[model samples]
Target: MSQPRAGHAPVRPRAPVIRRAAGSRAVALGVCASEPSHEAGAAAVARRLALPLLTSGTDPRHCTRLDALLCLDGDDLSLRQTGRRAPGPVRVDFGAAAMRHRRAGGHNELLGRAVGVGKKTPLVVLDATAGLGRDACVLADLGCRVTLCEREPVIAELLQAGLTAAARRGDPWLDALLSRMRFYPGDARSPRVHSDPAADVIYLDPMFEPRDKYAAVKKDMALLQRLLENSPVQSDAGQLLDWALQQPVARVVVKRPIRALSLGERTPSHSIAGRAVRYDVHVLRSLN
Candidate 1:
């Protein structure tokens, strides 16, 4: 196999926050029957998953990171391209077989009959607090064009990595779905809502201030919170809400746990109750 023609940085693993010694080992994909493309892909997968290179084989000293692994048969790490942009050889989709992340089902209670998503509907979703692409993925799967605006580069890289790996595997459903989930890398307290980004609906999933001292956050959530040290802590929810109101969206829906209060002083147009959280829909005509 040959290398791809795109650029997507590797997804740093959440653990082992240290890079291995320079040239710790050599990695190779058999070329006797392997195409040059497979080499590039296998390398890329190692980087995306942050897993050791060729755990099943010896590590090489002269390697440019396996952009992908060529399949001798069916057992190999395929790679995925990140998105539509690239200036050179896109890494072979390596992290193709590793698809562990999935959407959280807790939001269903909040999505009760929310209008705006449907076939061919021009919906621009602003995930003001795109902690991860979980909710964003759900929205994309539901046919809404979602812009995942994330400020932290690390987590942003994770999102890109996950999305890339998904795309690389020729995952028909996920690829088709993520094709519509835009990733806006930066703070969204006041996002650069594209000229037509605002939609009939907007989605906000901000991290709330923990109400109890004894409540222990999940390890993954805690890790993410650590990665996003300066998130909403300095995020001006009121300012964000104000800015969102100026967008072209018709409704702004906020995902809040059952206990969190409504955002800012602005009252919601209405509220929908799910099992554990509330979806506060603030109806707006248009913010063009």
Candidate 2:
């Protein structure tokens, strides 16, 4: 919304490119026609993703060769694997995570510590890679004003839909929490993002190559990894980190697997480790 800072050009949204697994058939976007309420949504998604709508009565089970199905079921937009037991839709849930954070005393956890939550005043966080918005929700629940940036069009749509659904639930706490959050549909690396003065901390969670193939993988994560497999930006951690460093934020926090390699060549100012993940904190200026 603000003018791009001098020498920084506004970045435009790139056309969506649908990638499927090798040997997989073309995927389709469709609505369950029986659910007329979803028709408009499905049509819009089909146009955005550049996919054909599935004909009514075509059994989803028979589309085995198809890579995936972008389905608008009621108000939820989900990418489901055709012919497989539908992995649950990726949804944002602040309630459970918020409860856990509250039980532990919000912002006392490793993630909060890594984000400099207790310093000076209530922090404003830019969740630069808001994949499903789980971490963003936790931060908002902890009282930070969080802005989410999700570049991938499909994933952004899913997040928007999920957040809309959550708001409609009319739960007072959830409504108030949602009010503190905002969405920006653009790449975090875009100069437009760095020009924003609101973010006190920039959080990066670039998708990393999976090291575990067995029981550790959850269905939702597996689906997300599959979708992001061919994305050039998703695989380039160095570039993402470099962009974060250039921002004027007070700190940058990157989430990585506990034993995974550091994101970029620059060493972190400090790191907070948990059982499954680690947060690499890059201090640009002292929050204190």
The local distance difference test score of model 1 is 0.51
- Per-candidate TM-scores read 0.60, 0.80
Once fitted onto the true fold, the runs of candidate 2 whose alpha carbons sit more than 4 angstroms away are 1-34, 56-59, 93-108, 194-197, 210-216, 232-234
Count clashing pairs, candidate 2.
Answer: 0
After TM-score superposition, what is the CA distance of residue 135 in candidate 1 from its true location, in Å? 0.3
For residues 140-259, write the lDDT of model 2, one tens digit per residue: 767887888988766776777667767767788778778878877778766666555478999998876555432256875666676665443446668878977987789999988787
Q: After best superposition, candidate 1 residue 111: deviation in angstroms?
A: 2.3
Local accuracy of candidate 1 as per-residue lDDT tens digits, 77-148: 222211233112112122322222223354542462453454236566777666556777667766667777
